[model samples]
Target: MSSVEIKVKRLNSKDAQFKQTLLSSLSLPMADDEAIDLAVLKILAEVKAKGDEAVLSFTKQFDRLGVSTVAELEISSKELEQAYQGLSAEQKNALDIAAQRVRSYHERQKIEAGCHSWEYQESDGTRLGQKVTALDRVGIYVPGGKAAYPSSVLMNAIPAKVAGVSEVIMVVPTPDGARNSLVLAAAYLSGVDRVFTIGGAQAVGALAYGTKTIPSVDKIVGPGNAYVAAAKRRVFGTVGIDMIAGPSEILVLCDGASNPDWVAMDLFSQAEHDELAQSILLCPDAQFIEKVQASINRLLPEMPRKKVIEASLANRALLIQVQDMEEACEIANAIAAEHLEICAAEPRKWAELIRHAGAIFIGNYTSEALGDYCAGPNHVLPTARTARFSSPLGVYDFIKRSSMIEVSEAGAQTLGAVASTLAHGEGLQAHARAAEMRLKK
Candidate 1:
């Protein structure tokens, strides 16, 4: 397609209607559909009632794999080892490098941000602090069929392992009884305790509520289809879940000095993820924007997934002319993009201006793709402006904390009077009496 023929929206940041237009365009269809919710509810109820039988039935219906019992679904350790051994040397090497980098990064995160118990004593001899502990078990759901994401296994499983989770159970669908060896290898490498060949909302239900075979998990992490997302939302209180992610998104803030083609491909990298994925470029130079547009047109046809990229670029992509890099940064903060790239002469200078982003790719050499794979940061990120409130999946997600309080006689004397006064004021006589009884006569 010609550069002019591409339908990507072009807007100037100074336009009067720019804010409204941008908001409308950036809006995602995240609202739950009634049909999907109903379907998920039914599946969850069935799985909860029937347990392993329901899981097996759904696997057969959805994945077209007939198995009389759920025991047939569990992948053995020997099978995992054989999968690892079956990989080509190049694939094995790539998986090893990615796993090592991901593990190292998460281990650092565990030391810095993962839970740790701490306590301190006051003058009145009252001790107060937090007791941090990792979740006993976690379930990770990896998408299969359309594509096999070994990276998803590493990203979700490694963090839980680093946080000292005792068991990490993984569930992936195997349509037509086809298993992706690379995914199994990744599971083996990441030390996942169990692998189950079940998927969809049924798999999520099995994870949330324990079955005869599949043990219940403390939390479920990883991406899935719309049904999986809905199931996660429904089962949230029953079991913790990572954020409900939307489509992948990337916002590029270029200083006009970087190569236009490089910037074009970076935008394409995210757009190729799906038709709903968004890719935007904010630059001060109109000429550079045009050059990038030209490069996009020139290079887009060469992409293997050209149709999906074209649809994404035409429907969701944008090239906005900003007044300057400062204005671009302001716009980026408002967008709160999943992936932000500052491709400029001094990327760090602009990076300081960025306040909200799932991950920031700095400098010309740092493509968002690198961060997606071997750049030592979790690729599972917040989407649809969720970075404003949420964060990328990390070691912290697998841990919990409990408050610890110990009060001595002197401390109780001081605290009981205040507690009694407040409780009585609130008309809770039982609470007032309980606190007063703790006080010395």
Candidate 2:
């Protein structure tokens, strides 16, 4: 089948203007200092000083549905047992299946120690190898305000566990002190050692600085709101953070044979995420483009999240009939979408041609939704075109590496003069003399 085709149609200036406006609207949300920042600072200071008392106080002040003590923060086996009872039989089954798939996929990212040996004689012998090690602790922030995402719990926690982090802690916000049974279940199953019933910048501060109630973590990972992102930004130097993630995005590249219904639904999946979420379709078929637009108009109203989808479509959705697959790939790479679905016949072939994307979904049935939930891939991905430079959360994110070197007396003596010469060239008398002394001995 031919791979190139050019479709020319007048660009919608209004649509173009809308895309520009939406892209510019990527600003982080406003946080009042008196309301949020000061509160966060006080909580941070209190946690730093008093520890558990501060955490419990903030929990009561903010998440005042029922939790009154730190003990309430811990999820018990009884909670997990009841979680299955609350879920419909189908929902429970889906969670079980998704957990297995996600776990299985991430297990492949585990690494082992290896040795490299080499002998060189300058005046001595030397050997060098590199070793990788996991961190002592990691903190994961799960969004629990707008909705419950058990999948996120699995995606963030599984990687750290696989990386062999000594301790894994999770922080979640409960607006009215309501915990999602499924999320708690996922946490329990994922080997999370401790779960804190706190969130926002304060939660980040507690994790970064270490509180009496919550132990300080080495690195923090997960997706969150703009305030959460800004807080992560604020606390970056004190503690390591994964990324300052932006809104969710998806770009689908399709051929003339692509199904309009499928495209429409795929776009809806990202659109429903948030008003700022972007869903784009780039293809060469004018008919297919028009059909997908019509399908969006038809199916959007029928969905319960029509208002959110409508806002997202009006603000961030796009339908560009590009010149060809080559042009489509160029535009997709430029956008660097969090999710890229290639619905072309040779999806794998086309996927290889692309260079920038957080995750690539292939073929018609391989929709972005699968990656979001049960696909066994990390859903916490880079957004706002950062995928060009960033990668999805994985076992690698939780580990650190150090280079090892061993110099034999013979190797050091053989190489000493060269090292001394370079050190002397840099005008470092101490360094040169140190190597020279070793050589002399």
List TM-scores for all candidates, in order. 0.96, 0.87
Candidate 1 per-residue lDDT, tens place, 146-262, comes to 678899999999989989999999999999999999999999999999999999999999999999999999999999888998999999999999989778899999999999999
Tens-place lDDT digits, model 2, residues 1-441 = 111111212233235474464345433344453465555566566766776677777667766746656767766567766665688878778888888888887776563322122233333346666667889999999998777788899999988888888999899998777878889878877888888778776677778888656789999999887667767877888889999887788889999788899998998898887877888888888889888877877777677787888888776677777778887887788788899999998888788789999999999989999898898989989988889899898888888877777888777786788889999999999999988988856
Lowest lDDT 10-residue stretch of candidate 2: 1-10
lDDT of 2: 0.79
Q: Best candidate, lDDT-wise?
A: 1
Question: Which 10 residues in a row give candidate 1 its minimum summed lDDT?
Answer: 1-10
lDDT agreement with native, every candidate: 0.93, 0.79
The total number of steric clashes, by the backbone 3 Å criterion, in model 1 comes to 0
RMSD of each: 1.8, 5.6
Colliding pairs, model 2: 51-212, 122-414, 123-410, 123-413, 123-414, 124-410, 124-411, 124-414, 125-410, 125-411
After the best TM-score superposition of candidate 2, give how far the Cα of residue 111 lies from its true spot, in angstroms. 4.5
